[model samples]
Target: MLIPFLIMLREGIEAALIVGIIASYLVQSGRRHLIPAIWIGVLLAAALSLFAGAALQWLSAEFPQKQQEFFEGVVGLVAVAMLTSMVFWMKKSARTLKRRLQDSVEHAVHDHPGSGQGWALIGMVFLAVAREGLESIFFLLAIFQQSRDWAAPLGALAGILVSILIGYGLYSGGVRLDLRRFFRLTGMFILLVAAGLLAGVLRKFHEAGVWNHLQQVVFDLNDTLPMDSPLGTVLSGLFGYQAAPVLGEVIAYVLFLTISLACFLRASTPDTSAGAPTGTAMPAVTSPAASSPASNA
Candidate 1:
């Protein structure tokens, strides 16, 4: 439950930020008329994500045991890939995101005047929302499959509601968020979650009879900390804990965490090149739609 809540919160904030930034930019440049298009795009994206998730879940429910395992494995694989990419991409681009967005707005409004402008912005907003929405669906689906508890979905719903409040506060100039610290912390947690998903994917593949090597049990902790226990269930839901993990699962989990963490840390390090510091915490941004011209700065 906690895991799903946190993941959804992070993902929700991300989607809200993208839409907020774009909407802010449009208003700033005297293109307030296009604002409705942004909301339209958001609604369309939400509908699409809901449909896709429902379809996948329905299809998987009808599959045989082995086929179901294979489907789960494939979904987990995609979720891992998307989560990894999102972490790295945000780390790389968070600083420039606002500026690039503003630039894109300029191009969209100026390069193609009239109806084309609205379409361009709609497309931009649609893609942005859809990317985050789809990512959340896959990640949540993986969690839901494992935990199979009512709390998981409820937690996710709570997270989304809270994120919407936060997003609205930010937009209304009522909230100040240290986005840099937020992303950094969440990114680390997400990496751990992705590692667990990857391990789970491997197990699913084995269950589906796609791979059989390295199946020896590495350790057993059932007597001490069984996965079905209260604490064990929390850990399992959060980090994919196992009472008796296979050798392959252990190896894959360790290797993924090692390499991924190394890269993430290195990327986050303050660059000392040219005697100039880099990777400073981004200052809390004022409402981008605030009347004050310097609000965004």
Candidate 2:
């Protein structure tokens, strides 16, 4: 339950932040007429995400047991990849995102130069929101398959609702937040979740009989603390806790978390030695007001 809630919360906040940035830009630039188009794009993206998730669930239900395991394994692998890439991408882009988005909007307006402007902005917001929405759906699907608890979906719904409220607050209520620190902490938590998913993918692959060479049990903690217990279930759902993990699963989990964290930390560190080029002023889009407080909402 907690797992899905956090996942959905992060994803929802990301989508909301994108929309907020675009909307704020439009208002500041006197292009408020295109606001409706932005909302339309958001609605369409949300609808498409819901449709895609339902379709995948329906399709998975039709598969046989063996095929289902294989499908789950594939989906888990995909989710890990997507989650990892998202974390790293957010870390790298957080600082420059405001400027880049503003520039893109400006380019779109200039390129279209007429009635087509609305369509261009609509397409931009649609693609941006849809990307995050689809990513969230995939992660949720993978999580639901593993947890198989009613609470998971409920948690996800709650997270999304909260994120929407927060987004609204950031946009209209002028809420102040330290977005840089928020992304950093969430990114770290997501990396741990992705590592667990990677281990689960390995387990699913073994269950599907695709890999049987390293099936030896690494350790057994089930005797001391059964995974089906109330607390154990929460841990398993939130962090992919395994009581009797196979050797390969343990290795994969450790290696993924260790290496990924190292790379993430290194990438997030600033290069202080490099000085800015002379005769170049920071763009207005990079200004504090222009960037808006909702960039990370």
Q: Which candidate is the best by lDDT?
A: 1
How well does candidate 2 match the true structure, expressed as C-alpha RMSD? 3.7
Q: Candidate 2 residues 152-208, lDDT tens each?
A: 899999989988876776666355555666777888899999999999998888888
Q: What lDDT would candidate 2 get against the real structure?
A: 0.80
lDDT at 62 for candidate 1? Answer: 99
Candidate 2: residue pairs that collide: none
The Cα local distance difference test for each model comes to: 0.84, 0.80
Output the TM-score of candidate 1. Answer: 0.94
Local distance difference test, candidate 1: 0.84
Superposing every Cα of model 1 onto the true structure, what RMSD results?
Answer: 2.2
